[model samples]
Target: MQEPIRQSYEAAKELYAQHGIDVDQVLRELEKLKISVHCWQGDDVRGFLFQDQALTGGISVTGNYPGAARTPNELRSDLEKAFSLIPGKHKVNLHAIYADTEEKPELDELEPRHFQRWVDWARERGLGLDFNPTCFSHEMSKDGLTLSHPDPAVRRFWIDHCKASRRIGAYFGEQLGQTCVTNVWVPDGYKDTPADRMAPRKRLKASLDEVFAEKLDPSHHLDAVESKLFGLGSEAYTVGSHEFYMGYAIQNHKMICLDAGHFHPTEVISNKLSSLALYTSGILLHVSRPMRWDSDHVVVMDDELLDIGRELVRSRLLDTTHIGLDFFDASINRVAAWVIGTRNTIKALLRAMLEPVEALKKAELDGDFTTRLALTEEFKSYPFGAVWDYYCDKSGVPVRENWLAEVKTYEQNVLLKRGSRASIVN
Candidate 1:
């Protein structure tokens, strides 16, 4: 396998050299780009703190796949298995609800001490950490309104949670020596037509003002706000619409998160990157797959994913853009979901980096649309899979579908045992 990989890589290198695409340099750049793998996927968004509570606020996990991580250790172990199959070191994204603490603490009362275990794990593995405030699934959010809730106390509780989340995020950065992005996303909206929308927007604006009032150091922590078009219940009105957050983030000098599935089906975040880059200091991307809507399906190497990669590479937004995966699929092996989604994401970015961007730009500048389109289409069928295989082999990870064998072996030995234990307990 090594010999075949080396031979294919050499041939592919020569082919890419003819088109002015350096495959070696592209791999190096890809190594520098880290994708923050979300932790919720391992347990289907059922965080540690609120396991007894029903998942609410327009969020639902459809499948009951075996071997869902039931403890922090189990989740970390699953992550370790998934990471072994992946090629590079990456960060883990966590929500406030996933805190590990013996004492029951409210979301507003969360602290850095609660997440020290996660910090230790990340530090040991040479990985970074990112955070988010859980603004749903609690009693306060039972009515589907949080930051913009009419009750001042309800809004205050969420505001405090966000504030505490920032401190924890800053703590992660300080401990790990890597900047942590703390993103805020609230599931606050109405299912039916609202008679008064301005009031909620005004309240939300004021609440956010309080959340961002205490400015933290930029070196250790960066703040970002994510907006959604609509959710299962919030189909009629979403308090934090795209335009609202766009204006707020630009005004507040905060990074804006552009979720791939948070807009109209026809709309793509690739096209919005250039526009947002001009205003926002930095951008946080939540890359996910949407089946007609925001389904949070495991990401695939599809056309839109490729387009996103191309835009990021061509626009030179790698330095300012933070890429993170946001999807949970319980229908398949949980660990396999992480491996598949993450590998496809890296492959998409790798394919984009392997493109001859200068040639395409030159063709476009010279008004040669035909050459531009022709080269774009021609590059699609290049020996991308061969280069990807070589990268996997070089990184000491399994090449191609060979990783699946290890996952299957793990399922039989580790995952199946978990299911049997659960059945006996039940």
Candidate 2:
């Protein structure tokens, strides 16, 4: 297998050289690109903070495959397993609800000490950390509103939570020596058509102002606001619509999060990157696969994913873009979901890096429409798989579907044993 992969990669290197493309340089650049893997996938979005409550905030995780991580130790162990299969040293995105604490502290009272274990874990593995404030799944958010809640008391609660979250995020960066991205997303909207929409938007704006009143050093932490078109219960109106956050991000000079699953079914985030980059200081991408609505399915190496990679690479916007996965699937092995999604995202980036971007841009600039289109179509057939296989081998991971067998073996030895014990106890 090693000999065949080496031969294939050598042939691919020569083929790319014909078009003035450097496969070796592309692989090297890919090694530098990191995707922040979400921790929610390991536990089906069930954080340890509130184990008894049902998932809320207009989002739901479907299917119940056994072996969901029940504690912080288990979740971290699962993440380690998933990362070993993936090729790059990536970051871990965490939610406030995942804190390893014995007391059920209110969201506003959360402190950095609660997450010291996670920081130590990341430091030990040389991984970066990203964070999110959990604004859902609590009694305060049962009304499908948070920052935009009409009651001043309820709104203030969420505001305090977000404020504390920023401090915690900055702590992660200060300790790890990597800037942490703390994204704020609220599920505030109406289930049915509301008589007035401006009120909610107004309230949301003021709430955000209060939450961000404290300034944190940009070197340590960055703040981002995420928007959604609609959600499970808030179908009629979503307070944090794309337009609302875009305008806020521009005025506030903050990073705006573009969630792939939060847009209309026909809309893809690939075409929006260049436009947003012109106005915002940076962008945070919540890379997820949307099935008609904001389903948050596991990502695949599909057209839209490839387009996102191409646009990021061609426009040279990678430096300003923070890539993170956002999906939860419990029907299969949760660890496998993380491995598959992260690997596919990496594959898309590798393909984008291998493109003859300079040549294509010259054709466009020269007004050679026919040549540009021809080259665009021709490059699609490039031996991207060979390069991908070689990358896996070099990274010390299995070279293809071979990784699947390892996951199955892990399930039989680890996951299955857990499931069996749970069944017996029940």
Candidate 3:
């Protein structure tokens, strides 16, 4: 998937090297011309247990990773006690400890008072609070029962959780002019063995049926199941569009939210899943950029967009909101690194944005998305224009050949006084 593009870039690199082109200057120009992708999601550490991987260093992943992520005071005050500067905005999407885990030790082992404040807390800061009620095969679930688990008692437990979750989501929506979306990813597939779900499938269907039948409301939310592969030789059929399209086939209002990286690992340009999702009358997409190497390191949409944008636009599945920074920084200095990586990624995307919309129009007549044409590096880099060229073109500005030399001199003489990684990250 990344091979062809990397190869093309390599060829260009060689051509420039042969011509003795100044790479550093070229890179700086590229960096200066970019835009931030979303600039939200804090894309760093302190948000998740893991380090922000895009930065210096990161923690490694292990199976069944766990954390009881506490937010006794929004993790803000506690964080202030640890660091000199504030991290990015403290955002929450449902794992708020004070909200759900607050102890009451009363009915169902907790009182309603314990669960009541998340609505206001989330509203005050304007974070879209979200969570999945159907627990996976972990200690969190009653006997590890997902929606599909058979024991009626366990099923009842699952139902109760969804009911409560829906209410919480809805309360916020009703009060805040928003909607709480429940992202349901049924982790009910089999392990590496002969698989049969004749009985379990029935239970699974019943579980979702109960969800739509009894657990939904105007404020409550439900998105489609998370798309994933099946184990061993079996194909995942839980919501296979052809066979079950449980979320899409039916016309009930629930929509499909495609994780950018959830589709095929080997990048094949199909219509953008979001576009396809929109065609299925779904919107409210989850926006993490895709990577041919890993799903989680969501960095650039242009990389993904170039591969699938035209079809995605053609599919017209939905419009994009702020592209979600669905990545985890598994590295040191998780915060600043997230910002830097985002800056780099956005720069790359802005480079693409610099591309004229006219290209798409020409491509429409051409019938092929990838008909090759000679594109100058400046055109590719400065969707706006060549760094100096743009200033000249739009603002009637001019640059001398010694411009780089002059800028470097001033930056060192003055700007270099600015100190520390803290300035960069914070």
Candidate 4:
């Protein structure tokens, strides 16, 4: 540590101790902290080592084949790989039960089929399956807004998605003896300026209002209302910040689903996001660095990395169950993104949570951005050049092609296992 940082550490230590914080205990949680990733369909389960006890396997649409028609054997084998590779106790984000299967004409009573598969998958694993609505799709949301959309067709599609999902979620809860964790991440905003901002936001409010007032089935579901900003690549809108509630989603529609990466282009901090939804008492956070506009560089070279992370975790503003990894890999090796991003998030969370809570208290009480900057500088006295060099170094990942083979074997076992030895739970 540099001379200045060593002094800050001393001060931070004393302040933290004053608040009855135990550094060692907090550090242990950090070490055990595993990140959450989804199980995409094309992924190889054996490529990554997932020994960490706290990591979660997110069942994301991008990761899993939610839209495909699979035999029970195929589904079971795919899930078995997920179970074998990912830590069992971790969570899975259900993007939805039935993906965009409208194009497939051979299907009938679609809801029952997917629900049956989902229930079977859940029963064998004894795992909790969480659902996140596939919002902002081209079909159901031509103009967007589950609650606020002017078009009746768009709004009705959302209702069907919710109603069908709730029924399935309830079934899973009863069959698996686990509640469905539902998150509404449906996109409902504009690409350009609208005549009224609240107009679009109000739609979210209405749907949330419906969830809050009716259509809640505990046997099948638990609610966490998720929202996010429109990408700049898309068109711009006034209520598009994703941080501001607009109207319906928070007060009327559903509970809060806060994703920190959702705020990067806006440059909002973690504390601000937590504060907004902290009152809802239903904050489900999606944690990740959004590397947009070159601002969300997820390196630890500066306080921008730890500044907000420390603030949020230290304040206990977030429940551990509410956090998940939301990182994106512009690179080829996806697992590396989960590893490095989780490592950074865990490290920051520990330093902030385990250290003296008052470490930043003095800086804030001092009430000067410059002083806070200096203190952060002292805390992070690592050589700048070294940090940059390390980030620039692309870690190598060995490529594999056996994921399809494994999927095929799993398909035969789960769907067509006449002579195969694969067990349902195995």
Candidate 5:
């Protein structure tokens, strides 16, 4: 460690000790916390399954950033670089469209063998894997409805795809010895006000029931359903609204995914955690930065992000919560986007873990709001940076913005060379 960093950590450790916060324990807990990084960010959600498919389902990657990964190996290589720059081991979240098979299998025909390379890659790094069934950006979803489409043939295709995805998720868990969260987030909604919304929702619920009919081992595979308020085209009505999924998750005993960008601009997932934790079995958080709409900008260390971490730590919901990042900015260096967002997420959680939660809770319980407020504000200026730097140093990652230099070097040497190979959209 650098001498200055070592000295700063020593001083910060002593300062946190005065507030009854064990810095060592905080770091240890942080070390164990894993943030699942989404593979879509590396290639702007353009998975390897389809070559000519434009991003449908209200999903669009802005900017024609050079060197976006075109193949499975390139994406994995980029992910490796991003993982190296971030602290701690984490899981890799994959979509069904990211299958790495030589055979051109239909979505419904997809099997675990198609994603064997991903499992092998994850196993080699001792990282867990999470999965999603890609229900958008396909020929079947041209009308912007999936799973809830009125046509049974269309609905059956998506249902089978989701079932196949769950099996792949179970295979990941069984092979890696970690529970794989197979989350379902479909873009089944209408652009205009529907004459009948209830029918679509009912169809969706029934479709989901059939999709999850074959129960997988809970120890290996866990199911989660995601909800959205609105999307680019589906601004009028979204079938899987929060209320709908919240009720469904409670009834079906499944995890409900809360994407930060998938709600009203005024609503924050941090506030929903405590209330939902009371009824839901588990939560899958897709942390993102939404600028007014569902424009998935890269996550930053903003107030909402900090509060999300605070809620998880404060409410003791860390164990039941599965945190995954969901943002794709093709405008920036894709690998750097991953590093920046994942590191900030860790920082947010670390900041919360470093808090004197017990004392704060006691003050709240005793009606000492002033003390609680004062301490909360005061800790913001505390030596959190020192401890964070130390943690990064110990984890063998660059501290602060220093990681940017490595990303720049990678761009010059590795990323730029792949520009010709990258599939740039517009």
Candidate 6:
């Protein structure tokens, strides 16, 4: 609505027009894209299930940042604040551990009522909800094993937990009238070398089969399995390795989640999308940044992220790919982290949408590698920022870096007050 922004957007529109790219069309498409924001980031994976317990299952949040949400209401409020600053309609991804209840219900006993509050909250905002079974940070996962544990009792407990979670996911989807993707990710592995790797994987496959024995309607719920190369404790052998999950997903006709930080340091998920899409029904992307490990750092508009957005658009897999953010940075303002990551993700997708894909593909098909490379390089300097700002303006979100001011004000007035309350209670 600002005069300068409108003028800049007009100039950028003209520039893109020269390249046969419609900035308006790109903006329209970008508006339709939705990225599910992870709830764990707001609380650093510290769910309300056990207030005194430390983070378990080879996961840890580094910073002792203040204003971490301690209750369902607080977390939802914080999420609303973050969503207000980011453009576009988005969804919220919840872990089973985040059940809004006063009594500590056993994993196997968890039902749809535990999440009724979440459903009500999301419905009020016209937002969809995704879910994950909390396979970590509990006594069941103390040994870094759950579904693949050698003990039948331990494995059965986790299976029941997963099954219960699926039912909850179905409830979410049925109430919201949108399919909820309930992903399974267990920290089942060995700290050192294992005498028998195949045995654990076999056990895992059997466990999954039992958990997914009863199929829910696809319209209400979708199942996805996540794999990690290694983790803090399971460095030597991760039972649910990428190869294992890929094979299992393909054989069972399930969605495979490809996390950006769940692979070798040099490997990227963007290149894997095309190949995997050919076999799988769809993909669930856990977009995150890795600092030499699965650190789950806040995302930025980096090259890898841009490549991911480009691949999703270029391959025409946007409809098949379920995009969601997966990161938890306790070092900075949590609301700002959400706003920055979600906005940057939208920005990357918008930039990819603005590309002249038809021209580049034509050059490639005509065997004009030189022309293709030239066109690709030239797009790097396009006025994508202006279009992004225009889109933000239209969405009623802060344009450029203006959102940072709102976050700082919120930290001073709202977040700091929580610290004061804790001190008073102590």
Regions of candidate 3 where Cα sits further than 4 Å from its true position? 1-92, 95-101, 104-118, 140-145, 214-222, 230-251, 267-270, 287-295, 298-302, 305-325, 336-354, 366-379, 383-426
Q: In model 3, where is the ten-residue run with the lowest total lDDT?
A: 55-64
- Which segments of model 6 are wrong by more than 4 Å? 420-426
Could you estimate the TM-score for every candidate? 0.98, 0.97, 0.57, 0.60, 0.98, 0.97
Clash-forming residue pairs, model 6: none
Tens digits of per-residue lDDT for model 5 on 272-377?
Answer: 9999999988999999999989888999999999999999999999999999999999899999999999999999999999899999999999999999999999
For each candidate, the alpha-carbon lDDT, in order, equals 0.93, 0.92, 0.40, 0.47, 0.93, 0.91
| TM value for model 6 | 0.97
> If the candidates were sorted by their TM-score against the true structure, best first, what order would they fall in?
5, 1, 6, 2, 4, 3
lDDT for model 4 comes to: 0.47
**Which has the better lDDT: candidate 3, or candidate 5?**
5
lDDT of 5 at 215: 86
Q: After best superposition, candidate 5 residue 179: deviation in angstroms?
A: 1.1
lDDT of 3: 0.40
Q: In candidate 4, what are the lDDT values of residues 1-426, reduced to their tens digit?
A: 245444544555555455576543554444343333343321222111111112122212223322122333443444455334332144444555333232332111235345465566656665656655444433444544454567766666666666565655565566666565666665555667767776666665565555445565654666666545554323465243455552444555345666665554757456564565545555555665555532222333145557656656656654523555454332222333333444455445554565434655676787866766765555554332222222222111111222334444544554333322123212
Candidate 4 TM-score, C-alpha based: 0.60
lDDT of 2 by residue, 78-145 (tens): 99999999998999999999998777788999999999999999999989999999999999994899
- Give a tens-digit lDDT track for model 6, residues 53-168: 66877787898778888678889989999998999988999999899987779988899999999999999998999999999878877579999998999999999999999999
User: lDDT, candidate 3, residue 292?
Assistant: 50
List the candidate numbers ranked by lDDT, top first.
5, 1, 2, 6, 4, 3
What is the lDDT for 318 in model 1?
Answer: 89
The predicted structure with the larger lDDT, 2 or 4, is 2
RMSD to the native, candidate 6? Answer: 1.5
